[model samples]
Target chain A: MTVDTAPDTQSQIHWFLIGMRGLFSLPAIILMLSFVGFAAFTAEANIPVDQVMFMTGMVWALPAKVILVGSMLSGAHVATAFIAVTLSSVRMMPMVAALIPEIRDRRTPTWLLLIISHFVAITAWVFAMEKVRDVPRYGRVAFFAGFGITLTVTNIILVGLVYGAVSSFPPIVSGCLFFLTPVYFLTSIWISARHRVIYWALGIGLALGYLFAVIAPEYDILLAGIIGGTLAWWGEKRLRQKEAGQ
Target chain B: MSFDGVWPYIYIAIAGWLATDIWRWAGVIAGKRIDENYETLNWVRAVATALVAAVIAKLIFFPTGALENSPLWLRLGSILFGALCFFIGGRFRQPLGIAAAIAFLAAGLALIGL
Candidate 1:
């Protein structure tokens, strides 16, 4: 049976439909909110009280916020904290590379590009890739603008709430919110995998990283990603070649 | 605690935001010339995805703070249960169900004290 490939116009219409489908999905909304809540809490705990509110409003990721706040809390020099936070953000380079093709257009303005660059965090990037991939290239900017604005507003509000309500909130509730950030990430990865070896890589990587961290706390993430990623790449290549030969 | 002023924080936040934006702009410039299905890009995507996966797995399995305090078996069980949920959810093409599974596993762990 020949598969029916719809015309490009029809396909574009279908893409918009899928985008709308994801727009109202519960997981999409929760994942978006959880990312903001985690960033807010991290900022609150680590950032100086003065910086906490503002960073939560702007800084996109928890790791960068953690580094920024942690360094400042330790009374490190401002330059030192900046350097630390920037170093933590080195991972963003690859993430940006992966996301750019999904959003960029020939006519896209430089200033708009600047705003997008500033606004695209890891959570936003992943959401854009998964939810907006099928969106017509011409419509992606609007989709991103809509999605990014919602996330930004949600983050600002959540940070404000956490900042103002921390004293009254139960410990478990706050903890759960924090916990959901990683949980959401883990579940998303688990759901998105199309290859079996990727699963093996994640499983082995976690075990090795955790054990090594117990022995040497520093470099756990570096070791895990480098070692696990390399192994998965190699294994996947070999598996694909074997299938081709068959 | 003395650094209670907001100006310094705003300056830092603005600076951080700008610094991160640099990478995004560069990606946009570079993306125009690159082929998405190119083998090199595919490998890059794989590596990036794997790195993220490694980090997420470490967070769930090793954990910290309240999660670290929870019993080891509970953590492992919750993750396994969550993975199973992810599997079932994906099989049926339901992302929300997978998220629900994770939330359920975490809440269950918290309530059971293990």
Candidate 2:
């Protein structure tokens, strides 16, 4: 059984196919549904479907896309939208940082790795991280690109289709659809979290997000993240020291 | 450069790509030199995770567009239920948590005659 696939493992296309198979995985399926919800969201905002598709493809990260659309819709200045989007997507750095080492071999070119890095959003990151170690070292790039490309292209098309069709959807239905994105975000983040500090971050971020929204609605997300995240990091460091000292 | 007709689209494309991809590029550059488990990466991860959490919380609490129509209690309750089940669902947590939240949303909407 293992013998048949072993020979082909060296071929990037073979590993790419293996990665594409992950499109049917549970997270991928849920992410597809979440994108459908995202499409309905852009529709309600009166954004052109083409623009929605473009943003989905370009931004790729759902949260950043949401902040972009939300800020744009609210008539936020271009600079504000830019900063909010940048802040929202800063997480991609860590995700790519963590995932790159797993997939890169010595001979892998930086350019090729950079292209693969473009695809490292939450779902694909989680999926690739979980599966990459099982892949032969050289094929990891193709394997990740296969899944990432397929996912990005599929979502771009999915958003276009859903945006067109969702115009006819009842407000209640679309609202329910929109709700899936947050639920997916919450649960998936919880599941993918590698450290206890995430719980602290989540709790503090949530509380401060609400507080900041009241006091300074414009900078709420950025402020909450920076302040809450630093506090959580510092607090966790203290806890670690206490345990080590004992 | 104007905030006129084609400008927002251009902005979305350029800004969106840069905002997200710059980090990926940085990761590739930095990843080459350092251990993935480097302590500094943890602080970066913590900040990133916190930022995302803030985004999620904001979506639920100060939602714009259609989700703004749902009552606060319904939104809050449904998400809490979903979060709780996220733990209990174990192997099927992602789907179960998602399904659980959507179901609660639909049910809550229907109950309130929405």
Candidate 3:
């Protein structure tokens, strides 16, 4: 027997409400905490207080923001700064690709289709990927918008407030705050993986990253990413073909 | 174009911002049209996954700022313990390791005085 998947009308509304309720979700909370760490980074770097809000609103990705600030602070040329930041954020593309289709229905407007694309941050992507299947397609986008917009706006305000206050906190406290983002990211990655390919990819990628960091710190991450990814993809293809042949 | 001026930050933010946004918009367009299993899509996920892994490894292995003060052994020890605890916590409760790891590191910090 076939299982019915399309949610009923009332259930769609419920899903929409559930999405809106995502404001209180753990991912949203982690998103805010990550911004707190970023605020502390700016404060420590002695970035002008006025620019903090600007960065938060414009370069919303924390990794891109980190690269942008680091490049400029290091006296890198303008082109160099732009490239570094852009490269750091390239991961968002696949993330958006993976998440957008999961929720959008025929009624979703083109303008909205584009606008919410910005909400495909790592936290939002990870969270939405896990949640979209639970909701009807018609309501899933609204749910994403509800939680995504809430987190983004909350983070903007949090960045502003934390920027003004982070300097006052002791170094260790701020350090721990900074540490939270990457730790959260790592944990989330491990939790999200359900396939053998991803598991192999993660292990190989991490090992390569560590080895390269020790030997060539300047250009290791990008190179390691490329090589490790290619290797993982190759292995996955080989394994998949073998299984299919059976 | 003074390095210290506010304009550089704005310029980089806008340029880099657009550069970054381009991919997501492209994703939206492509995701709408292509099957999720399109062959090349695997490369994108793989690369992104690797980048994420690299980012995490960097943070844990060669962290900056206050984290720099903690000895390498201490940082590694905490993560090792955290991962072990995470595995033990099982699927639904993995986040418990995050708190446990933090507490483990905090306890070490108290003893070592970072």
lDDT of 2 by residue, B1-114 (tens): 233588878789766878888988987887776555556666656666676677777878977666787799999999888878877988888788888888998899888887
User: Can you give the TM-score per candidate against the true fold?
Assistant: 0.77, 0.83, 0.86
lDDT tens digits by residue: candidate 1, A1-246: 111332355544554455445546554566555644554455456544335556755666666665566665577766666666665565565566666666765665756655766666656666776666556566666667666656666656666655544544444555465566666666555555555665665666666567656765555555665676667767778887899999
As for DockQ, the candidate ahead, 1 or 2, is 2
Docking class of 2: medium
TM-score (chain B only), all candidates: 0.64, 0.73, 0.75
**Best of the candidates, TM-score:** 3
Candidates 2 and 3 compared by lDDT, better number: 2
Model 1 chain A scores worst on lDDT over the 10 consecutive residues at A1-10
lDDT of 2 by residue, A14-76 (tens): 888888988898778878987887887778778888888888888898878888887777877
State, as a TM-score between 0 and 1, how close model 2 is to the true structure. Answer: 0.83
- The whole-model C-alpha lDDT of candidate 1 against the native structure comes to 0.59
Predictions in order: lDDT: 0.59, 0.78, 0.73
Q: Specify the CAPRI tier of model 3.
A: medium
